[model samples]
Target: MTVLTEPGVDAAASAPVLPAGPSQNARARRGAPSWAWLGLVPFAAYVILFLVVPTVLSVGSGFFTEDGTFTWGDVAALGDPVVVQTFANSAGLSLLTAVVGAIVGALVCYALLGMNPEGAVRSTVDAAAGVLAQFGGVMLAFAFIATIGIQGVVTVFLQDALGIDIYAGGTWLYELPGLVLPYIYFQIPLMVITFMPALAALKPQWAEANLTLGGTRASFWLRIGIPVLAPSFLASLLLLFANAFSSYATAAALASQGSQIVPLQIRTALTSETVLGRENLAGALALGMIAVVGVVMALSSLIQRRAARWQS
Candidate 1:
């Protein structure tokens, strides 16, 4: 078994050589044509045009008069009693809907957790959630009106069948209180869509380990499950809150009699000539919304990052 090799060559050179430095994928990416980055151009342009430009215009308008003269008057509208009350109403509505939606949706996710991931029920639910999450606006409002409005099918049925008066006090369905049901309607589906993945990411081994240590089912959830999912739950809650806060069409359609929330208030500011010398007030309200939503989304991103560590 004599082996011959060049005297000057290193023996290690003949050994199975491992590629050094960057990976094939990395090198291929590095060598890619510069034109490849152009794929992002359309998306970047879209964001700049739709998001960046509108945000800047909206925020900037808040500090200027209708004549383009800079003034703090418009900004001061944020402190107005009416504006403040509108914001409070919107926040309260959003909070209520978010909490309700998160709890109900979390329960739904838990129910689905033990089911086959690809089963008929799960598939149908996933499809329905995806659709319903985006199912707000005038169409939803119209559906509600057709089903439960004054003289509508359900209203008539309840009045005739059970002697019930849904509107005995007043037309609550066309008021601020009315927006709650519709807001929660879409919020639940959205919560389900966002929170389900986090639920699915919970490793079965964690539960097994808890049981191995002589933990009861209740104890396992209280000690391990709740702590692990808390971040994700909070993130989804914030997301739902933001979704509800920014909702306009459903509220607009249902509560057409008054500006009861921030979005509707903005609509009033833009449409009404009664509020003289404050035409730019809508911009101020918009800025307020942007600030609130921005803070919430930032918090959500941070919590999502924490939750992702365990999933990864």
Candidate 2:
């Protein structure tokens, strides 16, 4: 069909069509919802000034040096053992946190199975978990310190009242194992929170059905519960891992500089710049972090889809 004879085209052709002139276009642009456009100015300003500008500068600056001289050394410098070790360690930690958190969270979810935990338990769990989970960086570190730091409440109580010394008892908060204590502390509650919904989704009827079919609690859990909750469990686990991996202040505050998490190294590089003015190292590290977060979310999505299938 010709454009002139096309049904909708012919119908519109009958109506008087207005033409735009330069003056009208200018006026239109000027009158165009000034407040709406004005409101966006601040947001746009932030995006341009901070996010876009900084990203561009970082990318551009990565190819330069502290003296504004161009060089390929910065990009090539990522091959350093320090960088490699940090990446490997962070990756391992991320995976470890994910697995540990997932298992713990799943168990917590399972334990609360078939219970009517609606009111106080639910609210308290939610509020407390929210507090602990959202409690990031320095605040979280301080909270742990208050609870378990040398002069912390638990430490003081153990030392004075029970004549016990956790520090002397080999609780090296500066060590990796000791590092996991706080990680686990936050992670256990996190796991319970992550798996609580999926666990509660396990109906008593399913258990009853299994038992009627001659399956014991252990067998039912093994066969039915495990398979059904696995995806959601994995999703939550990946989330925990990602969160723990990207974390900095909590680990820094709890451990020694020798413990050196990736984020901490990034911060140190940004602040000190003694490591070859390696803020691009920070950017490269950030890009890696973004990639990890994407992978975790994607895995979570995959697991969620699988869980949906299992439920079906």
Candidate 3:
């Protein structure tokens, strides 16, 4: 009877549970396909080396003193006007770009989803969008330069043939609009790619049902379609903002100076007299970008959760 007494909690805690199902368990336990994870290694390494490391270094560097000693001035200077202004500009532009790109992209995807576009048209459009979305930084800047530079084909035509003095009175090449040209270029493609999945999730029967229920097209779209698609749209938009705000080469290629984006500021700080101190500034700026991206991702997740709740 004494031997039959149960052991302590630690002994019971060592017990294992039965498998729920062959197909339902997680990959590690169920011996599921490893392709996804196997493929993820290189991609993950790239992200860790390039993106994550840089981000951590930038944020941590801000807290460390120039001589490898640490201080709070880096964190404390988070409130600097120039720092504040750069973030404000970045946040505002990112928000604006995300919103605009999301709307336009969703609409475009929706239109395409409904359309049975075939062959050349579909391939051509897909190719073009892919190129634009994947294209950024220096390559995009150079493309913009080639298309609309001082001696660019379009610029030359606009100036010489049309006698348009846009470059004369308005050097579109060295201004906010110039930066916007590339932003819009990349932003639209991001929206298009991000929305494609959501659009695919859109069941035509849902639209049909709504319309059958005496709901007008606009009402169905406003009440139903948008609610479902909002998360994807917002996520993509935020991504666009992140891409645009983090972008350095394109902006640098576009503007000689005075734009003063936070990333560019960080790059400039690298070459500053107080390079050590400025690296901290650069770190703070990066943390700000991460915060922006985090906020956007969180918001989209919330929207998705709310949508699910409403559905349930």
Best by the TM-score measure: 1
What tens-digit string does per-residue lDDT give for candidate 1 at 1-312?
755678988777866677775687788888877787799999999999998997898888898876778978878879989888989999999999999999999999999999999899999999999999999999999988999899889999999999998999998889998888899889998998999999999988988998899998999899989999999999999999999999998998888868999999889888877776565888888989999999999999999999999989
**Candidate 1 backbone clash number:** 0
Best by lDDT: 1
Give lDDT: candidate 3, residue 300.
Answer: 65
Indicate the residue-level lDDT of 32 in model 2. 73
lDDT of 2 at 285: 59
For candidate 2, write residues 48-70 as lDDT tens digits.
99777866665565676667777
Model 2, position 119, has a per-residue lDDT of 67
Model 1 alpha-carbon drift over 4 Å, by segment? 1-32
Between the candidate structures 1 and 3, which one is better when assessed by lDDT?
A: 1
TM-score per candidate, in order? Answer: 0.90, 0.71, 0.78
Candidate 1 residue-wise lDDT at 225: 92
Candidate lDDT (C-alpha), each: 0.91, 0.72, 0.72
**Candidate 1: lDDT over CA atoms?**
0.91
RMSD of each candidate relative to the true structure: 4.2, 8.4, 7.9
